[model samples]
Target: MWEETSAVDKYGASPTGESFEPGRQRQVCTRYKRKGKRHRRQTGGATRTVMALDSLPSRVVLLYDEWLKLADPRTEDWPLMASPIAQTLIVIAYIYFVTTLGPRLMENRKPFDLKNTMVVYNFSIVGFSIYMIYEYLMSGWANGYSYGCDLVDYSSNPLAVRMAWTCWLYYFSKFIEMLDTIFFVLRKKTSQVTFLHVFHHSIMPFTWWFGVKFSAGGMGTFHAMLNCCVHVLMYSYYAVCAMGPAYQKYLWWKKYMTTIQLVQFVMVTVHIGQFIFMKDCPYKFPVLLYIVGLYGLIFLVLFLNFWYHAYTKGKRLPKVAQKSKALQNGNGVHHSNGVAKEATNGIFYGTTNKVANGFHHGNGIHNKEK
Candidate 1:
């Protein structure tokens, strides 16, 4: 019994050696119970944190669904308007090609001779632009559209339906225009693929998706109509250019194209700005009014800067003068006529001339000719 007590005092075990005294056992159980409770709390906290993390994607999906609910039910079923994913992927692929893969692939390759292809493409766009213009006019712009306070005709009226259809066509045209950059890349006119160029091409379709989905006609259609008109002129210039050097004389109004573009943005800005002063302009989605106004103002500033640099700053030299300067600089050796010895070589002359005239101008736009 004394040995047993001694063991209990030394090792905290009872006489059976398998258990502790009741008081000590209670303390040990309490300690383990406390640890178990703490572990359970920690596990519960971790589970909740995991649950919150798992809910993030669900939350995003819910928000997207809510946003979709705001879209025009009529247009929600239209091609490319059903989801933003298609246009988004298209823009991404476009950027990746023009900026990255396309340039790298062309690094060691001769520029493709695409003059014939370009002519066809440009004129095709001209024809398409004309079609869109007529549609815009017939549907609204000419069909009793009050340019001052036109609101989106969200009805099943033949005219309204026609306008919506026209707007979708316009949106699709933006994708078609992206081929412009692809042509530039193919022809090795990478210098023509400026930030303004890519941005204009990519943003148009993406934004127009929303436009067609929400406000397909009315005040918004004005810019689309005006843009189509400008494109008719712009693509016509490009088509003429693709016809060869004999047609160079017809491009005298090259600088004026930029002027025209500037005018377009100005008119767009002014037209959209009228909403700010009008009272009770029941224009559904006043948000779009602000967006169009801002878009116009931003492009106006960008094109203005382009004009200032390309024309006002005297960066664009006359063709003859440019050719003459290029010839003199070609080989650093000028003949008595002030032409480089290499000027006799058609290849050298053409290359140097192109280099001399490759100035940035036009619709974020056309080729180096601008």
Candidate 2:
């Protein structure tokens, strides 16, 4: 039953008729003033914007002032609090071994047919994504999120702890997903193991560990949720493809998969971009938002590059094919209207044959020799 007016004006009392101590009221009021002053300083002279709640829905502002104000994520008893560094080193070693050593090891040996294993692995990831989506909705969005400046809940409250656990589970899933490139090497689909692929799989968990460590839930979790949704689609595609040849028809729309990926990055970038423009969010960790936003942009650019090569440049003849074509043409390859064609036809070349044997036997030309 808190009111928006209470945020700035009625700080000396609560809705339940409890009176705040005069000294406590003064301290809280001073903090509010300092927040405004800091906003004005950091926002590049939008003093009017110093009162950030004015731009937000009153209900949301009230929610922030009442229940969300009690969040405390700094307790020392969190799980997996000690293993991040070791896990990161393991990830680094995994990357090095996969890109360099694994490919070499795979070079001489026959590629293993991991078709059945891949089907199982990819679908399991899809199921994990489904669980994450449910956890995110239940623990964060279901709580009536402002979707604006929602901050993490650090309390031992059951729902809050659930959100934290979901965040960690999402992080751990990325580690499991590193097997993507390992599978590629095993199958000798080494061509599929590109820089963009490894960087995406490896760096994701490494950076997300920080998200789980500090702010496990909030506006920040939105992209994580969206990414999990996209992974559901992505891994499902891989699973279907691994079911042998019968499923190939189902993959006719595979060309649009990269389009879908680009869209995901765009969504993430926009979601995180809100933190930069908003005058104030309930969240204090502005740096985390910047990191998330930059991560979105970086991946967006990398995926665009992949799409350009995979679709645009991929349409052309490969290097060896183009070389053979140029050799056959003699004068060089010719391109017109995006289609390659031979520069010369054979009828003209036969004009220099001295009309002998009717310009070569079996050509069906008639010339009498006396």
Candidate 3:
């Protein structure tokens, strides 16, 4: 019976003895299971997962549009809140607690195992950035808006929830950046926290808050793109450095990191200025320009001062040493020519050989190679 079963279906088998399952039948459909048809689910967070483009419900899109209008009401109708002074103080206090107090508590603690943490963090942020980059690219070609528009109206699109989630993550990163200082404060590497250090830490998160708050137009994206790229390199450098001394020399790009930061500000200022000047595009302009302009000027001044103090002074110190070296090479010793000539001329012939010997002795060049 078992042998016969191999040769027959419920009805019968082909003459060649080919058989099929009794419940099975031939189907000619060419389509394979589509990628998202099953087991596809929301990811990232509740707001992000359910509201994703793949499974976005119509109601969510409507709600998102409503939210965008609320978030970015027309320029004239914005309700006045606290004065800038009050708001600024509140924001500064908030940063002091989040960036400073938290880090101080963790001071004297061993550096966190940044390797594993950074790996997970980078992978997630990089994936999120890639998603946004793709969204921007497609939106540019097919959706009519370019990079800036994508960012400004980002909250209104179907995928706005995901962008919001990622934007929040980037905002939180500024807080994480405070750890750069904590490591300084803790490790007793106080020299690292120069004025540039505190200024960068203190200002950036606030800049981002206003950026997201005001809808900062689309021109703000150059800031995001440059930041993402810098973080990619910066965190990777940190990850490698955490491994050991092997990476110290490999970090020659540290110099370039500062350069990149300066360049990022320049581009940001120019982009914001263009929006302010042109008075074009989907999002508001002059508002972002004013905010970015102030921030950019602060950064420019602080960073240029830092560059001068760190590198310019550094270069000058070496040049000073080189000049000293040249002077030493000109004379065998550091003694003045007058002292040498007086001593030698008074003691010796006061002529050709005496002067020559005096000069050689003064220069500290014992050898006759010169």
Candidate 4:
């Protein structure tokens, strides 16, 4: 017994010769209990965090539902205005094609000869623009519109309904105009697909969706009408270019198109700006007026920049013309190759080449290579 007691003391017995196993076991159990309590607290916190995260999506969906309720009931059943998803998808697909897939596909493929198609397409847009212009004029601008503080006629009046239809048609025309980019891709004129080009094309339809959805006809239609007028001249120019080089004489007014675009934005900005000073204009959606005004201002700045770089800097001249000018100056420096190389650099870099090769402007105008 003494030997066994000695062995126990050597291992874990207290100095008083008492075995420490029971006390040690108690300490170990206490440590485990404390650990278990801490684990429970951590697990509870984790569960709460997970639950909050799970509810986030539900909250977002609820917010979206509330937003949709604010949309115009009249346009709720319209084709693309019913939901934003269709238009969003269309814009996404357009970006993808023009930026990535279209270019890669056309890498090895030859450019399509679309002269005839372009002629028909341009003329069709001209005709459509004419029709829209007439509708806009008769419906409001010419009928009895004050041209300032014109409210949306939501009533079922014949002219109001006609304006609404015209607005929808105008909205739809934005999508149709997207084909301009598609043609560029198909023709392997990918160089014309500048950020401005794609951004303008994509953003127009998306923004117009809301415009037509909320305020179909009113002062909102002013820009649309002006845009159609611009399109009339722009597409007619494109149609003439598609006809052949024999008709080049008709294009002497090409630079004026940019001027006209600048004028259009100026008018839009001034026209939409009227709402700011008006006392009691009951435009159903005053928010849209501000948006259109800002839009006009932004495009006005962009086009002014374009005009400065394109015309003021003498970059709007044709390559052949530029080379001839260089030759005539006795500079003995041939810039045709250099200009060509610079034009391929990027947007706004060698804008002359861009403007020369029928670059599509954001305002739906195309300048064919001279």
State which candidate has the highest TM-score: 1
Q: Candidate 3: misplaced stretches above 4 Å?
A: 1-144, 147-151, 154-156, 159-165, 194-196, 279-282, 305-314, 318-370
Q: Runs in model 1 with CA error above 4 Å?
A: 1-17, 309-328, 331-362
Question: Each candidate's TM vs. the true structure?
Answer: 0.80, 0.63, 0.48, 0.77
Query: What lDDT is obtained when candidate 3 is compared to the true structure?
Result: 0.45
TM-score winner, 2 or 4 = 4
Error of 4 at 143 (Å): 2.3
Compared with the true structure, all predictions reach lDDT values of 0.73, 0.64, 0.45, 0.75
Clashes of 4: 1
lDDT (0-100) at residue 37 of candidate 3?
29
> Model 4 over residues 1-370: C-alpha lDDT tens digits?
2222234343566555666686574564566667777877999999999999999999999998897776666767878888889999999999999999999999999988888998899899999999999999999999999998888887778888888888889999999988988888988877667776788889888778888887889898899999899888878877777777677666677646667878999999999998889999988778888888888997788667756655577655546446566464364223332332223222333323223234334373333442
Per-residue lDDT tens digits of candidate 2, residues 47-107?
4565665766886767755643333344224554443667778788888878899989989
What is the number of backbone collisions in each predicted candidate, taken in the order shown?
Answer: 0, 0, 7, 1
Residue 11, candidate 1: how far off, in angstroms? 18
Rank candidates, TM-score, best first: 1, 4, 2, 3
> What is the alpha-carbon lDDT of model 4 when measured against the actual structure?
0.75
Where is model 2 poorest over a 10-residue stretch in terms of lDDT? 361-370
Q: Tell me the tens digit of each residue's lDDT in model 3 across 1-370.
A: 2232233444545447665444442220111122222323332355575567556677776786575564543221322221124436644765574456755766666644444554455345445555544543343423454534334654456444334434545555666556555444444434334454466567766766655555533555455655565555545544544444454555555436556656766766666566655544555544665776667666656556545644576422233334455565465323221112112111111111111101111101110100
